[model samples]
Target: MQSCFFSTSRTTNDGSNETDQEGSNKLSKDKSIKKNLLHENIYTIPNFLTFTRLVSAPVVGYWVLQGNYTDASILFGIACVTDGLDGWIARRFNMQSIVGTIIDPMADKTLMTILTVTLAMQSLIPIPIAGIILGRDAGLILASFYYRYISLPEPKTFKRYWDFSIPSAEVRPTMISKVNTAIQMGYICLSLLAPVFDFTGHIGLDYLGYTCAATTIWSGASYVYTKDAVRILHPPSNIKK
Candidate 1:
């Protein structure tokens, strides 16, 4: 009778042990699944910062259209700072995402292009300045098309230290591109502020505008030249030689 009792007790303990182990395994799997889902979701803090810039673009445009240069300048400055902050946060925190990459630059180009056109329409800035900025942007677009069609190279999957390929092909933004953006943003803010602060008549605005124009040209040219050189040196094997 005692042997029968001992056997029964042992069986019960064994079954309990098995159930506990299974539960532990399931918990671990659940945690791992949650972690993977979190990583795939792109709503990080840095991306939030980028979103702020996107939101500000329309507000800035509205203010400009309303002839409120002062408020527009302030909002533009905030957007510019947010751009820098988001990038710095992403790099520092390793929070870079494909969405952030696309939205950040799009927000910048949209805001600047709208402001440039609006200012020109108001005769606040010289038509020549707006023309030069637009011309550089158009040239970059053309070069991008040429690279895509004429130079059909194998898609590079990795970025090198000195690689400056356009982000449409690969999602990485070049350091020089970031610098150029910063300079352009600075110029826009200053230009907008000049009239609000009664500095439009001063010679400084002209000098700054000229400097901004030159930088735009140089940066655009460099982008095209770098992409062309990379395509030549590292043509994708899939592309015909």
Candidate 2:
């Protein structure tokens, strides 16, 4: 009877060990799945279109500096078309992605920055207007960096910081922000084409510039006051309960 009791205790201990091993394995699998969900597929047609704009921005800047307005205008027009098309395609086809949200504005800002700087250098865009546009964008960019850092999960290394696949925050542009971007793009487009058409000193362009400035300031303020402008996808581990 004593030997039988010892044998029964041994079996119970073995069963408990198996249960512990199963729990550990399940926990490990859950972590792996969670990590996989963090990384999204960033390659899509919309992304490709947005990428094209990023590539074209510098070329447009070079042309503007070189006084090659005709080709610059053509390429800029194409870039603008792709910009709208990509967004539409993304929505229509359910190809929306977190990376697209980041890069689309990035492409827009890159193009606008290059053109604004080059045009300002040539005295096409008023210095004050350029400053306003640049300043607003700079502030937003800095805010984006802050949001990204705070929203990122723990172990935030440099590699993870730059990894767009691991989306930390999603930016939702405000209504005024959308309007501001549209006005800014229109103003820039006209500025790019004015030289080609010999409308450099047109009073209408001046009015557009003033409108752009107003919208730019308004939109920047909207982002500041709007609580939902940037949504945190995954708060840092420290921030989590």
TM-score of each: 0.63, 0.86
Per residue, candidate 2 scores C-alpha lDDT tens digits across 54-169 of 99999999999999999999999999999999999999999999989999999999999999999999899999999999999999999999998998876788999999998889
Off by over 4 Å in 2: 1-29, 235-241
Per-residue alpha-carbon lDDT of model 1 for 1-241, expressed as tens digits? 4775443322345466555666689878777754443234467887787778777887887888788998898888788788789889999989876456556766777788888888878776688888988887776556545544433333433442113322223234455665766776667777678778877646777777787777777776676556433232232343232
lDDT of 1: 0.66
Off by over 4 Å in 1: 1-40, 139-168, 171-179, 228-241
Q: Considering summed lDDT, which 10 consecutive residues are worst modelled in model 1?
A: 160-169
What is the lDDT of every predicted structure here? Answer: 0.66, 0.91
